[model samples]
Target chain A: MMRVAEGSYAIADAVRCCSPDVVSVYPITPQTHIVEHLSQFVANGELDCEYINVDSEFSSLSSLIGASAAGARTYTSTTSQGLALMFEVLYNASGMRLPIVMTTVNRALSAPLSIWNDQQDSFGVRDSGWIQLYAENVQEVMDLTPQLYRISEDPEILTPSMVCMDGYILTHVYEPVEFLDPELVKEILPPFSPVNVLDPEDPKTFGAFADPSWFTEFRYLQYKAQERALDLIGKVDKQFEETFGRGYGGLIDTYRTDDAEILLVSLGSIVGTIKDAVDELRKEGIKVGLVKIRSYRPFPVETLKEALKDASVVAVIEKDVSVGYQSALLTDIKGALYNTSIRVPISGFAAGLGGRDVAMKQIRKIVENASRVKDEGLELETEFEIFDVNPECL
Target chain B: MQESLFAPGHRACAGCGMPIVIKLVLDAAGPNTIVASSTGCLEVTSTPFPESSWKVPWIHSLFENPASVASGIEIAFKKFGRTDINLLVIAGDGSTFDIGIGSISGMFDRGHNITYICYDNEAYMNTGVQRSGSTPIYASTTTTPIGTQSPGNLVRKKDMPAIAVAHGASYVATASIAYPVDLRRKVKRSLEIKGPAYIQINAPCITGWSYADGDTIEQAKLVVETCICPLYEYVDGELVGVKKVRNKRPVEDYLKTQGRYKHLFRAEGGDVYIANIQAIADRNAEKFGLLD
Candidate 1:
């Protein structure tokens, strides 16, 4: 990331520095560059590891699961359809407590074949036993990614880790990133020593049937492991700051929200653009700020309630939907506000799908609508719904 | 030597063939082996609340990750930070030969130190006798019910042992509850092997197959004896061995033993049933040299 570093390239460098022993990847648009760069590194003997170019996303994850069980530090990357294909594997990796690090270039799932920046794809895997981290800029992509191995591989948090960045926005854009030295990275992350490994020297068995008798208890264990992961995110963040010089704001990053009456809440790279708009609004004496979400899984309910406690109005801008219900991330934020004395009205806005541009101008308009709603005591259910699809090409 | 890993006394029906297979398999695996089970009848009926049916240290994960769980358990032993446990996974047809296919294949392709055993009764008997991929051709289950024109399942049974071998598994074999001694012997061999080894057992079901409780063991033997299903093994991803199919009879004998294939021979076009069974046996023999 020393030169004209694209966001995806920075992520690729972080993955290589993390020194994942096995990388199982399947390519999909906008997200492919991160994997492609990593693959090239492996091919050029730049990364000393097993790089599996899988037949499909399913195989990609399957390969990682195998490698993880073999006690190899594994990595994988995907987006949208690719993520959907690895849906079952996500559960398998977490259930088995394999600390696999994956990069998800967030994109929309297809019905009519959309490939755009959205929270839906990453949000879809919210319940799986994995520590989820969202990166808002190329620097975060470079910085937070290697942190995944530290957090995920922690014995107390032996869970899969996902570093999600906006599909095309952060993945395609070039930004100056200060690449951490490999020696420093090695000192920071340390080697992965597995609790379990599949080896022939000592015979073992896996993937047996758990009849109705004892299935619940094991599921409870998976659930508990995820809970353990939430705490480790902060613990790892602290150690990261000590070595790397910058700390990730646990769960959510707050911007100028000290006396703000209106707050823009979102995740992924959109937060960068929204932060700019928040600055612009502040210049005009507007009491507006931005909250960039980091972790989505083990969604920071208590932490978020504390962060947004004083805000008068909160606007949720999402790229994914719950269909007849709320947008995916908005629902979690609302649940965090539940039973709290802070009665900040929240509005949900769905925008950007099918590779469509989520321009700063569009985000500025959404922020404006949100600021206008703050004037009244009302919260709109649907505002800034800008993802209306045009007719398909002939 | 495994001292019958499953403790005696669990309700697996009056003539539950699986527990017996489990007992023999565990005996073959010997005292050092560990078992991971899936969510199914064997796991549910044996290890009910507050108690377990196992004498050995056993665990039950979800239906899908038993192989993966076993993979973990296997690696744990390899790391043996201090344990000498041998990992063994016992699943029903629904879980092993089907739902757990990916993890199983992964373990095999990676050559993990684990053994996967599928106690196949040809259906998802635990879930009320539904059709699974391993359900034999012309088998009758809730999902593959007998109809006016069709007998039952039209698709051929999946050759899971062969699939395991093709994945470069160290060893793969088919076993039957009818032959406890041989089944135990195979288990012992699989346990001793260095990489992923798979064993498929034709454990009959009294309720699912609509057979008399007494006939469970009888049908399991008849299955292989009739050549409808032959016991065999694939070594090093190649068809290197076969079990004895002595005095092979018509597929009808195996079919008529259970109600699953009752519709096959009873239907008007049932005459075509022999050709299908013959085709299966023919392919099995040709594929691995099982019969003359």
Candidate 2:
């Protein structure tokens, strides 16, 4: 049934359908409503699960690590500072291969703090060995919730996943999301049958210290599991589509990219505005397109190369800057296309940072720059530009 | 003898008091228990990669998360309706009194049906005897080394059991590795309680304390007998039991056994610090009614 609901409620409903055995929560802005709805579900007896009101984001994720190790499907959500506090436990969760799922409501990090939409929070922990998926809108946020669990809990890819949605843009907005059918969700995501768990009948040691001789091999296994997730993420997304009849393209989604001379690449909800800009620019005879990267970690390198192969110039727009370098997604895309046969001028534009608006005009300017580089052979002045910055601010 | 749940062949130092405390606690907890250990001496020594001393399900996560982790397991088992199995957290004093205190406080405050046991070896033994919050006053540690203008650690041990009681834990107790029966009884009793329970055991570190390998139990006993580390119990924030000392021993008797306190005897004006320590023991004796 398609019903208009807040994005957080849609996500909580999707989580409910998946039947998590444990939900540990510590409230943070933009992520609070998700847990609040889940807590209500538990309170009214609609959801029979252990709802742990933990003390901090650290404890919340730590408890889920324990709960997930004990063979329970567990979950939690947090934004900027909360996600930063959970930095240590994030590595532990993936290192232990817990298959815990978290909704990383994306927001900008602290220091001159802002509680607004940005991908910096999720991108900051990009190398923590979690499968990171970005949603373009509220519907995608709802649809990706169960798929994250399905991918993370796969027997071959026993890694945790972060379903990142732009903070207030997707979390607080009202949208007509097609709620997942619990019966069909069960088909794709069965009851969590753990390969190993904390059971008295069958004892096992978890998170044991590895000496120098063995430590690298253990890390290698974790890396191999992440490598395995690149394929499993797409396969499970396909399975989700087969069962639910709606699917975002698994790793990377493309819009009018074929036979285009210029391609714009980005992630999260900003892709919506960029798509609108692309449509306007196309009417003006600018051969521009958009490649929405859904899965960021186990970064869709091969699929990205294939998508941007034929472009005359590729412009990357993102909400996070690596600060001293180009945007994170831009750097990854540059590295992906580095050794490949696809040789083109790639420019990066950092926009929408700290929830600053990435309007259609700014996106149009980025495409015009990329088109100028392609058509008139214009040389860029800097490595990347902060696209929306006012000249007076500097 | 039933086969010990904590198997041998791990790498704890000879006469290290932690293995004894772990063995006793696990023996009391039995096979129907899961353990969440913090990163400390016991976790590093007992489970190094491919080898684990635990015969029961055990997990060691971070330095200060064992209590929260144990809460997770306890509530998870509750969701499973498997109330027979016990959830136990075994951590070190560095984990309990210092870094892990917030997580522990949260665990107890939430009233999770779990028992947290802190093996207080007085310092951060795994990191080579750095002074921790549980380190006693005037005792020398790597972080509080004896030098000019410095006798030793200037701070008293943090009262973790009292803090536990303040959190409204159903049962809070302190034990020493010197008395196996007393420690085991407290472990079993804590498990029997309906809600959160806390037990701190003063397990002497053979290496960190620089004591003779064979003197761990003697040092443990002497600390209690001198009224420096009293054994007592609180039931729901009320003092219910105290382990009385029939004849109180001099504080020097306990201090002389460990090298950590050797500075109190050798350093100039060391007698003054020793007298201060004696005063601390006397205060503990009077407060706990240890002589009664």
Candidate 3:
């Protein structure tokens, strides 16, 4: 498990071994340890890169966007509010096809700040053009760091990839992680060679404005080109298997979905909890399973429908809410299956926002509630049903 | 890569002052440089692909990150075994002096061999002329509209050159399209330096300033000569050279040239505000060791 180590260093070490050339980051809570450790890496000459101590998180991504576009293997780690500040540059990073990798240690956005684990941080960034992958464990975080490069820099993909891990859960907690040798990383990722470079000798221009007349076409290229990258998500994941031995999914990862009547779906580190609960439910003769989606945008539609096609009840448990409408994943998942033949009823449940624990205890409760609703054959409340909503905590 | 780095047709407004400044900057930067563009009017107008006006390889990351992005480019080139290349970060005044100050400072502090150019159009011309850090006092931008009693802006122009110099920049200079040779010479000199350098050009946007398109080059010269924005350099934080106050013209001449500043003159004329502007220009001259 995470090399039998706990604390924030595993995330930092996983990143350090990747040998990022520049990390333009500003420290925000929970995320501070990751950058602080990386800063130490730069200070000790262990990581051969420039650690840009930016003034704000806004500047952090802005700086990373600069360095990454300049053809550097750039990395940044940020939590909730810091991420919001960098929001302005997030879309530009992906739109320009700079293969910048970011690790969003999930946390709740603040006013009355809670430096605890939550999914709101990463979930808020669902629309950013960067490819999004949720790590199920520290091991996945370690593997996914280098794997992101493969997915993002592929000639077909040439898009940004964000490897998201739960803040306190995976970012802080330790688990089994096989540190891939540096030589292996080199063999797999090599150095970043930007499809576009800012060279003075053979000068070029970038990031020029696109007004209304051509802005849609540019967006069309982004949306259409993004799908091509989704194809490379598979291509790169396959290549990742050849080099790293452990293979990650291009979109969705399933846990015993075949012949299962009740299927549980979760993202990030909570998947492990859901998996454990599924095992406990299986021992009791209940055919419960899991569908963990890694790549959220270019949301895993076809693969999801193909994987969870047979489940009688597909429980899409979400961490963050879309405020009023369907859970973000439910909307995307429904749309994914709208044109398809799969008629599995996706029971949407919202849980674990603002660091509220979606514990294995709660996961079992949600699954049971879904099963009971289906057995009754009535409309299970379509809007998100909180498993345990208490005003005392509020 | 070819001679026509700037294509003839662009979506720039008919009387846009940006193209002239860009042509001059690119000419100074020459064809071989790679550009790190901050999101701005220049980038938006010049690069509406499948038709790019760029002859050289240019990249637009975020609006306020060109300096940082240039740093990344410098690091990338050095790390990937590239040498003898120049990285130019071209951003608007709004991007440079305001939103991107921290990133620019970080780049300067890191001591990268990059040149950054802030095309000082005095305000945020891209997102519709809003007030910016570089917007002069008493100017009417969308954010800082002039009214009775109080003049538009109470604050003076931000001291960006002083800030860049404070950050251990090897070379810092002010240049305008009005002087191509000096701009080229400064670009060439700044090119030889092995650390971050700052060059802020006095580019006036006719669209925002309510001036004639053909007045673009002339107004730029006016900014330098009138001493409203004197062109000077500070090396190791010491005054090196001033862009010269050739027949130092009255601030009124420069002010009268643009509609944005027309309010500063008022219905019968705001003599008090005019005097205050004169004082700012005088302070600039003596502060930079310009005219005796």
| DockQ-best of 1 and 3 | 3
Give the TM-score (0 to 1) of chain B in model 2: 0.98
Give each model's whole-structure lDDT. 0.77, 0.90, 0.78
Candidate 3 per-residue C-alpha lDDT over B1-292 given as tens digits, one digit per residue, 9 for 90 to 100:
3354567788788766667667777776677677777778888777876668887778877767777667766766676677676678888999899988888888888888888888888999988999999998888888888776557766789989889998989999988888888877888778887788999988778788998657877888887777888777767667788866758888999899899888877644578888899999888887876676
Report the lDDT tens digits of candidate 1 across residue range A1-394. Answer: 2667887888898888888777767678988898899989988989887665545677676556655766778788889898888787788778767788888888888787777777788888887777888888888877887788888888877888888888878889986788877887887788998766554445333334455766788788777777776777777778778888888787788999889888888887778778888888789898888887888886877788887898878888877887777678777888789888988878877777555666777767766677677775454434435444465732
Q: Model 2: how far is A25 from its true place, Å?
A: 0.3
Q: Could you tell me how far off, in angstroms, the CA of residue A294 lies in candidate 3 after the best superposition?
A: 2.5
Error of 3 at A39 (Å): 4.2
Name the top TM-score candidate: 2
Stretches of candidate 2 above 4 Å error? Answer: A376-378
Pick the winner on DockQ between candidates 1 and 2: 2
Per-residue C-alpha lDDT of model 2 across residues B69-188, encoded as one tens digit per residue: 988888888889888998899999999998888899889889998999999999999999999999999888999998998888999888889899989999999998888999999999
Q: Rank the candidates by TM-score, best first.
A: 2, 3, 1
Deviation from native of the Cα of residue B87 in model 1, angstroms: 6.9
Instruction: Name the lDDT value of residue B176 in candidate 3.
Output: 84
Candidate 3 chain A: 10-residue stretch with minimal lDDT: A377-386
| Winner by lDDT | 2
